[model samples]
Target chain A: MGREMDQEPSVRTDQQLIEDVRNGDRSSYSELVKRHQKGLLRLSMRFMKDLDLSQDIVQEAFIKAYEKLNLFEGRSSFKSWLFQIAVNVARNKLRENRYHFSDIDDVEIGVNATAESSLIDHAVGNILQKEVDQLPFKQKTALVLRVYEDLSFAEIAEIMQCPYDTAKANYRHALLKLKEVFQTRADLHTWAPETNGMFNEMNAKFAEAAE
Target chain B: MTQKRFYADVLLKQTLKKEDRVRIPTDESFYEAMNNKIMMAIESSEVAPGNKWEKPWVFLEPGIELNEGAGNLRSRLSSKSK
Candidate 1:
């Protein structure tokens, strides 16, 4: 359905779209937003985890990217450049939230894998925004870029302006920390299949080793 | 299972609606807001942007080395350099 909609000529080619947006084409800008919003929101969620906050981050990132578009020399893919901007916005949000990522393993607990629980759950899928919000800034950003954005470590490093090792390490650390958090936080003991699966699987192994 | 699936779908739909409500202008106003921000950037001072928060955490993967599960992570990091 989306692909059919995206085929419209009004959207323009990627190169054409960039030129138009840069030249102040409103339709072109709207098309760009249409093409990128869903992906960018998902990316922001990986960082901020909150649907509202992720949407806000993507909105701010788009606004900022538009502001900076004139400075873009197209050194790399425009998508990569845009992604770099989103990461910056999300990371800034993370920092502002006072994330430390310290000793998250200490409070690890098993999560509930079932999302079939309540009216609120009936209202909004399982909200992991809260859990993701608690992740350390870099880890959350890295995980968002890696898993949600499916970006390569090299791309992430370029966007993050960090060593590739740093980006990869950040991602790994973030995953491990999340694993720990889901396990310890009973409130999250059953959030989603993916979360609880990883949570229980990790703890189940831990129990085995302890015995 | 449909009962489980139904609530899941409902929550997802509601969340999606919530997300839509949170979106900033994507219509004509979006372009205008963008132009204003760009004009500000154009008119403003130019300085190198660095990480706004670059505080060094005292522990840098210190605890990671102790955990057996983290070996894969350590290896992944090292591999990035090579």
Candidate 2:
């Protein structure tokens, strides 16, 4: 279903594709864009919450990356470097829109009774996305990169320009904050089966924290 | 463990699961448009070499090829003859 699927066993790595682009192979840049656009678009959606803006962010990030291709010294994996650029672009857009993540207490859930009812009546996923959007920006980015993109903490740190421990802490804080919000809402348990073994694991953690 | 704590923990995991299930739908049109936009930007900046956007070097003659070695030599000889 993808170019990667049709690609031979000896398909070039991202670094190889990047080298080709640097050597004036424009089609290689298209390959690089195809390899990364979906995930990067999702990442931007996490920040901007709008499809058009996310698409713009991804487009700008790719263009900027292409224009500054020479500056890429391969200090990290190409994906991490690309994520770094996307994050910077997302942050700039946030600033332009006057969005700031001040504190955990400042985070506000958009789920009122009407919203929750509409979501529960329709899709539970939207409810969770709204909750995620309410998270502090750093925590949300950490959680999304870890859970959605499945990137390592080292990569998250490089993208976020923070220490590795800070990235881990941000993820931990994000989960805890979401937990705190859900404790009062009994409606979420209906979706428990979907979590597979996560509920049991979480219960064990809860017991440990109490002890 | 407090019953309340357990409930919250479980609920959090449920929400995370739901989040994971969430997928924003995009179509081929979006990707194609983005490809066109990027290609347009790249093509427009061809004069800058290396895909960077910069003012193209002004040349004394339209057909003159700015070969690095030859251009340097021509500049040096012209200055000496001046």
Candidate 3:
């Protein structure tokens, strides 16, 4: 009996776990938490950037999802619904806190810097973070879901509570904006041979948008 | 449908991937402790009247320590439940 109880509950689907929880089996909720917590934490970290706050967001998301478990009509996947809850919680936290980022100007690149150097990589990363943080909230959210979470536009729309086209456009706009920022950095020219090709394509796209 | 590829997408993805490798921690113990805290919070809260839902708690206020679960588990499980 102890061995049976100790066996991993991952064999059961999330929906099955939901049913068990609804039937007053609180242990099933623990399984559900175990299954989704890591993913939820990663998603939350994309928004909050602070691990402690991200963990709090994940905890709050799970608790809220459980408290409102009765209301889940199963239209969307449980994962999608849970993510929507976490995104909302993270957004509210952002609104309350008003996160600040360091100025892009603060990242100084040495003339002798190479892509191989950790210093160059760190500086480039700082620049990327600053640019991403500067993006409009909706665009940033769409980009994060698409790029980091690897979620489809349909899923991104469901989570963002926006239309499918809107989500795609937000992601597109984010990439274009980031590309525009990168174009101004001559230091990044040495990063890759593909950099020039990317710049040419981005230039064409920018011209087409202009026309 | 074949999606149109953006040149910048590759670079952005690469940069973000490298950055995320450092930012997101993969320690199992950290997650285990977080899960314990969540379960403890859920276990301690009271279920609202006529509904099986427990009152939602505020987690972010000052003095609300994470591991201690000392935050007020106030009932925000009103119409927001839907």
Candidate 4:
């Protein structure tokens, strides 16, 4: 019973987790990584577009964040603070390797698509992904953080190290560009009908964020 | 969102979901690997006093440029050598 209880995720908050790690309960560090790694991995993949590179960046980011844990001031949630480190590490890896996020050709349509139009949805998704991947870096990051990660503009700004308005503008610009892209496509109406629910959700979220 | 914006947002989000499916690791081993990596890194590095990091070379607050001056010094020394 004691062993099983010990195996349970630390009941303490993230702040307490850090305190435990500081107190030399090193296993707590592993527990903390388990708690946060999935989100960090997803965020890293959005930025890097390569699983191998994303994994490396997330690993390095976790290590770096662990190293710099003392600097954390509790101003932001630990998750956001860790994201800041991961984002910076990912950016540095991209710069140092002279790498660019590749076009969205590799996207695999998720299982969430209704079965009837799975093929068509897959094709449209690929096209849209390509456009998003090609967006200016700032706009792409903002969109990913806002739309995909479901982060608020304030958090997006903190992660991107920009003014909140700047983050909002980047997301807005990204949407405008996508609007232009789809408006000119002849089959856009068909695709749009299939995606109405998604649009409604996106709009609702955006409105909520704006408020 | 306006009508056009709605369509764009929907399509963009769908595409993002696709990317998320392809890229995020969902397997058990992924976390295990991360845990191992963290353990290795922490073991190899010198633990700071109080189990906290040494002061970062650059304090990030505005108007703090102490670390920047170090870079400037390196450049100047290189220039003198040349």
Candidate 5:
């Protein structure tokens, strides 16, 4: 009961947070950073699987975001805006590691977090995420933007600087590849499980982060 | 991994949470640093581009004369050893 009561204003509207941040409320910046850091981290993980490097990219992205906050025109959703920045940062890092690249976009792959089975499943999921990370840069970008960002092919096209059809095709190819990888794995399961209403839960939590 | 979504779900919840009420800091360092960096960047930009040659060490191939001298050094060393 108290949980729901406390969550009411934390994930306040993005515009409100932006306004407060613009007014020199550093706490708002903190709130925004706290609210979005994980997503940015996970998104960066998509490009560079190394947790440390992704952290660096996420930090740099946030600093850049704060510096450029006034330039935001609100055309895109705040998620998309921040994501575009993180994606840019991740891509730059990937470019730097041209020889040693690995996919770290570790999606939840659907195991229960506390279940004993969750550990075994997470290991397998980590392996699969690494494989997904190895695809051509464009394909990896399309896949992550689709699955993690929840953006449509058209939206991905814009972020990826590619045509809509090309983006759609890349997602289809990437998913099919993942499905194939899952089928090949002898890990007692044959596919990636669905994560229903994942973003809804994210939205709820986001609302609670509002200060 | 679908579990990734769950982790992200958990993390997003954790991040949005406020730790302590009224934790705002009353300080001046943040503003000062931001101003300093902005000023430094502006100062660098005001120097017109292509107005002056960059320092020679910035060259990727070393200067053409340096490359020629390097070749001369190699040849001179080889000839002396012979």
Candidate 6:
């Protein structure tokens, strides 16, 4: 118990692990890979939609990051830098494959279908995903990074290699486009009663943006 | 800058969260295999000398199953280097 307690305090931050890796502790790179792989894979999935291809993108990103470790100058958090690399790799893959998203039929609905609510939720989820997938690449990237990843606009801008306002604008544009779907589909308005105020807020923001 | 909150954003997040619950693999073995693949890929690149090391995706051909163990990857990389 004493030894276990001692080991608990030795937990290292990502920067320290990076330093160790740079100093020839090869095992530290594996730690880094383990730390970020899930996040990287999820990010790649947002772009590729295919699990296998997303895994490949995550693998290549980690490999590239390991090779380019010396170039990571602490300009951003290591997580952000790693994400930036994965984003670039994902972008290249998208370009190579001509921006193909997975067919709607291929999406797996893993929820039980016996409940009517589950079926409705599944259908609504599909609509949102389809709309999101149809967004222009930059807008989609911004939306995913902001809404799903919960990244700051600054980090999103850095990953996108664009100005901060550009990143914010792209995300806003993506939201406005998504909002149009809710406007046209009366079924969506009844998604949740608690969301009505948020819908009004969004409309107000939309009016402000138009002005 | 403070980001404005919206129902659309909230709904999108909730919907994606549900999708993620199903899509993202939570298996420990899956992560272990992924970590092994990454480490082996790195090691293979270090063993081979060329521009191909710079393009790691050369080893990750589309539709190739990556969970195939490190030895298989090493042999594949060796063949590619030749």
Top model by TM-score, which number? 3
Q: What is the Å distance of residue A130 in model 4 from its true position?
A: 1.1
Please give, as one word, the docking class of candidate 1. Answer: incorrect
- In model 2 chain B, the worst 10-residue window by lDDT is B62-71
Q: Which digits, one per residue and each the tens of the lDDT, describe model 1 over residues B1-82?
A: 4454334333322333332322333465654554454344434422223343542122123223322221223434454356
A best-first ranking of the candidates according to their lDDT comes to 6, 3, 4, 2, 5, 1
lDDT, candidate 5, equals: 0.54
lDDT of 3: 0.69
Q: Is the docking of candidate 4 incorrect, acceptable, medium or high quality?
A: incorrect
- lDDT string, candidate 4, B1-82, tens digits: 3664455466566656664444566689868977898788877654355334443232223222222321222333344366
Clash list (residue pairs), candidate 4: none
Measured by DockQ, the strongest candidate is 4
The lDDT per prediction is 0.54, 0.66, 0.69, 0.67, 0.54, 0.70
Q: Which number leads on lDDT?
A: 6
Q: Candidate 6, TM-score vs. the true structure?
A: 0.72
Chain A of candidate 5 gets a TM-score of 0.64
The per-model DockQ list reads 0.04, 0.08, 0.11, 0.12, 0.02, 0.09
- Tell me the tens digit of each residue's lDDT in model 3 across A132-210: 8889889998988777877666667767877777878999899878877766767565553433354455444544444
- Which pairs clash (backbone N, Cα, C closer than 3 Å) in model 2? none
Off by over 4 Å in 2: A1-10, A99-127, A186-208, B1-14, B20-22, B46-82
Please state the CAPRI-style docking class of candidate 6.
Answer: incorrect
- Model 1 error, position A151 (Å): 2.0
In model 6, which runs have C-alpha deviations exceeding 4 angstroms? A1-5, A8-10, A102-115, A187-211, B1-22, B46-82
lDDT tens per residue, model 4, A18-40:
88777777777777788888888
Q: Candidate 3, residues B1-82: lDDT per residue as tens digits?
A: 0122443466567667666632566788877788788888888643322343533222122222212211111212121253
Candidate 6: Cα lDDT at A74? 54
